[model samples]
Every structure is written in structure tokens, then in C-alpha cells.
Target: MNAPNGHSWHPETGRLFRLVIDQLQCTMCTLTIHDTHHAEYDIVDMFNMPDYLANRLAIDIDKSIQIDAWIPEKSNQAVSFDYEGDDGQDRFCGLTYYCRADPTVLLALSVCWQDGSAPDEWRDRREAIDAWVDAHLRLLWRSHRDRGRVGSLEHTLNLFDFTVIVLAADGNILFANEQAHALLDVGDGLRRAGHSITATDFDDAVRLQTAIQHLSHSDEQTKSTDAGVATVLLLRRANARPLVASLARMPPTARGSAATVLHVIDPDGETRPLVGELCRAFGLTPTEATLAHHLVEGLTIDGAAQAMRIQRQTARAYLKQVFVKTDTHRQADLVRVILNGIVPIKASLSLPANGGNGSARSGAK
Candidate 1:
């Protein structure tokens, strides 16, 4: 690797700094470094030229090393790596650093150049700068590979209102953010046995499992370029109201092909309003509609009455009417009828006329 402007390598600021000050004039320079893990990078530190340049040079021991610009594509083309000036086309030269670690990190530095300066002056040092940057990346990657620590993820979760939970592929709870603890009925005492979360019944557990599976499959097929998908599932508790979980794929790219993030968003508002709307459209009275809606929501008659704030006798009477009007003889039958009746107007139009029956006549040719 060649050193910038024939100066020795300086760990304080890297080789790009000296080259910019010696070979170029009247320009501002910026240097930044970061780590890359989980297919992403986070910035670590930065420095501004001139002020930091003196500090960098003072610490250097070697005279100067010259390096060749490494072109990842289109080789032998001497292109000046612009540190800081305007290139007349409004494009400026910049350097980006990324570390390959468990969570990944990124750094970006911009060097603004003096206007109307010839490109050849900076081109001379391009090889040297590229070599230094490549070397820095190697060092950063090795450091992360050896060190295992959760740096920003712990404190960062507090900044968001949503609760973050990490779940293993086998439905075991790994960790939970602070918000996760407060929002759900989970804490150190209740979280024993590795089952931090509790659902109302088997159905709720199945729903969560299905959601996780769907999210995992979606994340895999979508590739890294597109925005990841969030899986939505209703997690209901016996004592507490249900929560809407927005499960997503988290960083470090799920080592075992699983969703890393399980965001449990509390469910807000009533769940039966849409069912009530359909009941009203089907000419059901408010009481009958309430019964029908709750039934569709998997509530028993007793449950529906409590929800409707009505006596069991009154609720039963309304449910009987709902069954009769909807031509259903049982609660399950009534639910099926009500759901089938609520087809959107556009969808109803798509149905074949005359109950899908076709008229046929005998004919002789």
C-alpha cells in the first residue's frame, strides 16, 4: 500500500488526510470509520482535516509509504479520489467505511474540494487512499469477530415506544426490551422457565407461531434490497386484552433462518365495529347485531352478554332472532351465515346470477 503524499502511515487519522493536505490546496477534509455486521454498518468515529491533521502527523513514525489506487471495477483508469472539492458537476468526493460484525456498522466521510481545481492533482493519490481504506476494513472486521457485546441495542430500545422481543426459532424467548416488560404482563419473576409471554389459549399460541413462520418465509424471499415485511398476529391473554404483534426480521440476519424481532403492539379500540357494520347492512337490530358480531368473534353467548352490557336473558333472545333471520339453527351456523353475508358490494357483483344455475332446453338439429 502506498502512503498518501509519501507520508508514513498514521493510525490516528489514516493516510488519506496527509495526501489531501500535501498534494491538494485550500480544501476541507473529513474522515470517518464504522463497523459492518448483519449486512449493515454503524459509524464509530470521525475527524476533520487541518485541526486533526497535525495531531495525526505528530504521532507517525515512518517517513512515507506510497500505495496504488485499487479499482474494484475498470482497472488501470487513474481516477482522482476527490477528498473535498466541487467537481464542477455538483458531485463531491467521499469515503464510506463498513465493518463486518455480528450487527454490522457503517461510516461515511465527505471531503469538500476547492472549485475549478484540476482532477489530476487528486488522481495521483487515489491508489494510496484505496489501499488504506481496504486495510482499515480488514482491521474493523477482525475486531468485531473477536468481540461479543451488545453495545447500542440495549440503550437504543428505550428511544422507541414499541416493545422489542427476541425469540429463538423454537419459540423460546431470548431477550426483551424495557418496553416489552412494562407493556406485557412479563417481568423477572414471571419470566422464569424461559416462557416470558403467556397467551390465553392454544389458538393464540398457534396464531403467533403461524405469524412467525409467515414472517420468516417472507423475509427470506424478499431479499435484502426490499423493505422487510412485518407479520401481524393477535396475542390474547386471559386477564388482559389482546395485543397486535408486528413481528419483523431483525439485524444480524437471523443466523438460523428465523425472525429476530417480535414487536408486540397493544391492540387499541374495539374489535367488533366492522362486524356491527355488516350486521346493520343485513337489517339486524342493534341488540341482534351485537350478538351476531360477538359470535363471529368467537365469543360464547355468556361472553357476548358481558361485552354487550346486557342481561343473559336479553342477549339470548337477541341471539335467537339473529339465528332465525340469518337462517341458522346453531351459534356456529349463525356465525358462518353472517360472515358470508358481508361480502363487499364489488365482490357480490362478481358472483354468478340465479344462484349459479344454468337453464337447459332439449333441441334437435
Candidate 2:
């Protein structure tokens, strides 16, 4: 399905790893895949970024980067290319390549070695490593692209009046919506450091980072217990209002990486977007969706009906269908289900008026 922002939530493309690369950079990281993020740990401190990447917009296969002592040469035979470490001061095992999603600059990684030389045995394993990196590179780029489409300012997360940050296990800030960027932009509260998220308050930073680190290292036994019960943290910015964040380990929708999702909410922010998601999730028609939204706002059925410009009987009819479809007889249970349910990316919430097969099909009523 799709969200109102037109980003699709589907089995093939999950929301979990959307900002994985960004998250990996927030902490000291080691990767078996394209290590483009390591560019932040670049030599020159002025821009504090690898000039090749810090200035570029995308990395296409046709173009290449000039690392100090090395040059990029695409290998039609292999999925990787080589780079000299620190302008040839040291030798490293690794290559750089870009993905279809972002082609202006290449991604990088280095298999370390002392004395700047690959061991004799390492030569035998080079082809295998290349194959692995090649296999995973494009997929990672796709994840970033998909995430940008859904979680970016043009999408649903930003339209709502809440701050959303997605992090990797290592506490790297992978993706932050528009609301989050504003908070980070002002120096005093929160901000982006080279490949990391930083805060003016040491305790808040430590607390959040620790939670994210914990989520990153969580085992199966602990993950189940931590799923719905999120860790809450208060980020007291320098001159801004304190931000209350609900931090949780978002279990992966598919296999591979999962991330820590931080939802920074305003004490009085409206939940209309969430309600819109709820309506689309259970096939609620426009009127029914409006009714459900009103209920979520703490209105009674009569009040909701009156507010939606419908008769109490019609509202009751819609409510009964909602109960049957949602498998809840009580209003509280219905509300809980909607609030707690996964916010799926779904198609449009459009449904016919007067509630037809919509109770069985879509939510807009």
C-alpha cells in the first residue's frame, strides 16, 4: 500500500533500513559493505569531509573520483575498484563504487592492513570480497532512495508536526525529517556533526546514544520485550523547549538491519496524519475515517456524528461496521488498536459515501 505522501510500504521495500547508512555514521563504525560514510573521517579538517564526496551531489559509474594517490577505474569484470590509503601512506584492501540511486559520487570501504600491503592469503580472498560488496551496494542505495522518498520533507513524516529521526544501531543519524532538521539547524539544541548527531546537553546525548547502541546490540530474547515498550528520553536543548522523544527499536519488516526510531513529539501536536493512516489501514471510508478521527480526539459517537454532518443512526451503522471489521466491540479497544497498530504506507483513502463495501475494503468513512 501507499501513504498519502505517495510513498509505498510494501513487502519488497520495507521502512526499517531506509536510513541505515546515515545511522552507521553517528558512531565509530566498521562495515563489510560500501563504506561511503567513512568519508567523514577524512584527512582534511576544513570541510571535515572527504573533498571528493563532501562537494559532490551524486556518483555515476561513468564518472570517477581522484583520491590523492589513486584514480577510479570501473571494472566491467568486477563490482569494485581500488583506492590508496592516505595518499599512498598506507595500503588498504577495498574499493569504491556508486549505485543507481546516487551516481554523482562513489561509495567506499577499506579492509585494513599494517605496513600498507595486502597479505599473501588476502589475495586469494579478494574476488570473494568484491562479489559480496557488489551484491549489497545497490541494495543499500535503494534503501536510502526509498527512505528519502517517504521520510523526506516532501513526504508524510515532515507534513506532521513532529520530529522524526531514524538511526542505525551505532547511533548514526540516518534520516531526519524536516521538523528534525530545524531543531538541529539551531546551534543550541541539536545539530549534525560529521557523520553523527550531536546535542548540546551531554546527558541527553549520552542517554539517546546509549539507547540506540543498546538497540543495535540487542539479541532476540531482549528485542521482543523491548518492541512496543519504547525508551523515553527528554532532550533539553540550550534555548529551545525540551523535546520529548519516544525511542524504540523498530523491528525489521523483512530480514537484515533494523533501526532505532525516535519520535520527538510536541505536547499538544494534532494527530490528524496518524488518524489518516488509521483510516486507510482498516478500509474506513471518508465519513467513517472522520468519525474514527473524532473518536481519537476523545469525542463521543453523537458528537463525532454531529461534527461529521451525519445522523446518529448513520454514525452508529458506520461504527458497527468499524467494530466488526476492526474486531473490537468497545470504543476504547478500537482507539487502542488504531493508535498501536503499525502505520502502514497505503494507497489513497478514498471511498464512496454512505459506506458501501468500504467497511470491508478501505478506510475513509
Candidate 3:
């Protein structure tokens, strides 16, 4: 089973936590606080709650439950509270367990009843529930920690507008970000072949494989020299400009079995920086920022004007203002400044919709 939010849900592990909730005849919610001081946390999982209530709790968690008042001095400290919903009609009795093993991981086990009054049996079984959590705390912590780590990495990779892929020493695909998967699924230039990524053209495939092998088998000195420098290759496509691929070896600490990290940028694809980001970074108006974005995306002044549906002279005026604000006189300088600036580092919220292509899979492929 999957979580309502599409997170991986392990029924067996969930059942372990659900056992106590069943015994107590109440709904259960599990939360993990990555940073308690700054109130950075997320609901790891929940069980036995109606979809409406769960959604409401996820959105208005801070307003509904106050956990800042009581910081558990030690691990396995269970704190209980009674709180009403925003409308004041729906009431809940919950117990939050804080396990400060890492000073960041707080396990909140909310046992809720809707009627404002919890049964006497719940009070009597409180110690038993705490004992059960203590007995299985390590297992529970590992499950949540691993899930959060994977989810965070996937999200971070998806934020990039370009394609990112991780390859093993032998060129097996270990992981691919959302953009990479989409690009591969399109089968324009690069596509997944068995467990490895392959280019459509013979020469491109040879060059790509050679680059991956070089990075994979590089000595310590060569690796150090190549650090921060990528081996650039161009993958030939059927219609568009060749996709530019930058290959670099992963750091020793992070490599594990993965040898190379490949970042592919499709020149003809929509790789425009956000207009709002450009405006804030360069202190330009929305129109000026939009014009600057087009320039950075490889559109000439006339081309940009045509795309923006404005007069050529008006576009030139916007470009002049952009140059003054961005401290760049030439178009090349403008593109370089914007590309190397903080604009590209900003994560794009909008993602391409997944297609029906059958070849977009991650993990050992």
C-alpha cells in the first residue's frame, strides 16, 4: 500500500504501530521532527483516521496541537494533551512521544478520540503503549529515517530543471531524476538499454561509455584533478540540437557503488530561468526580467521580441534596461551572469507530467 501523499507505505511496519492503536480503540498518527528548535517536521505516517481528518491535521497541525511548550528532556518521554479542532466541534486526545536520540528525531504518536472525552481504558493503557513504543523504538526510528531520506533526495533531484542520472562503475543506471526519466522516455537521443543508458547514435554511445569508464576507473590523483571539472559530451538527437552531457565522478564519501553523476541539458528544451527569480536577483521589472530570461534561454533580441509579442525596438529598450540592472553590456555576458548567478540554483516547482513511456525506471537500471 502507498501513502495518500504517494509516500512508500509498508503495511507490515504500519501494522506494528497500528497494534497499539487498535488495542486502545483510537486513531494513530506518527510524526518525525527533523529540527525541533526551528519547528521543522513532517507527518511520517498516520493510520485509522478518516481522510478528511488526516488532511486537516496535516495542514493545521501547529494550530491544532502545541508541542513547543514541552520539550522532552530525555528520550521516550510521552506527553499527552487535549485539543479541539479549528471549528471547536471536533475534539481530540493525543499523546506525543519524543525520542531525542539524534536531538532532531521526535516521534509523535497521537492516539485520538473525537468526542472530547477519552475512555478510562485509554488512561490505564498509557503505560503499556509507552512500553510498546520503547520496545520497538529503534525499528520505528530506522523506518521513518530511511523513508524521509529517500523522499528528500527524490524531491531535491526533481527540483532541477535539467536531467540528472547516477551510474554504477560498469555503467548500470543506479538512479535518474524526474527530468532524466522524462528525457529518456522521449527516446530522442538518450534512452535506457537494459540496465545502462545508451545514446541513439553509435559515436555518441561510444563517447558516453568511454567517459563513464574514465571517470569510474580514475586514480586518486586523476580524480582529484577532475574534481569540479566535468567531461562534456554532446548526444546527437534525431531533430533537436545535441543534448549536452556533463559527467563527473561522485565524491568518495557519497559515491558508494555509484561512480559517475551525469547532468544532461537539452539546449532546445524549455530551460528558462524563472522570471520572478530574475526580477529579484537583478532588480528588474517583470517585463525586463521576462526579456532577460529569453536571452539566457538562447533567444536573440528580435527572437525574444517575437516570442513576447512585442515590437523589436521595445524589446531592445527592455534589453538595455536589463543590461544596466544586471551590470552586463553584451548579450553573452548577460547570459553568463544569469546562468552562473543564484537563479539556476532556485528549484522549479512545476514538473513535466509523466508520460506513458515504458522505459523510465530508476534503481539498478
Top-scoring candidate (lDDT): 3
Q: What are the TM-scores, per candidate, against the unseen true structure?
A: 0.32, 0.38, 0.58
TM-score of 1: 0.32
Worst 10 residues of 2 by lDDT: 25-34
**Most accurate candidate by TM-score:** 3
lDDT of 2 by residue, 122-174 (tens): 44455544544544555555765676776555577755556788887666787
lDDT of each: 0.50, 0.55, 0.69
User: What's the CA error at residue 46 for candidate 2, in Å?
Assistant: 31
Backbone collision tally, model 1: 27
Preferred candidate (TM-score higher): 2 or 3: 3
Q: Which candidate, 2 or 3, has the higher lDDT?
A: 3
Off by over 4 Å in 3: 1-136, 219-228, 253-258, 271-319, 342-365
Give per-residue CA lDDT, model 1, range 1-365, as digits (tens).
11134322235344544554554442555433222212222223233444333223212101111122221232122222433323334434432222222233322333444444435655445455655554554554465434434646666665555567876555567777766777655532122234635444567666766765555455444546323457677766555666777777654354644544777654443435445555655557766777787788788999999999999998988877666566668998887766665532222233332232221212200
Clashes of each: 27, 28, 0
State residue 123's C-alpha deviation in candidate 3, in Å: 20
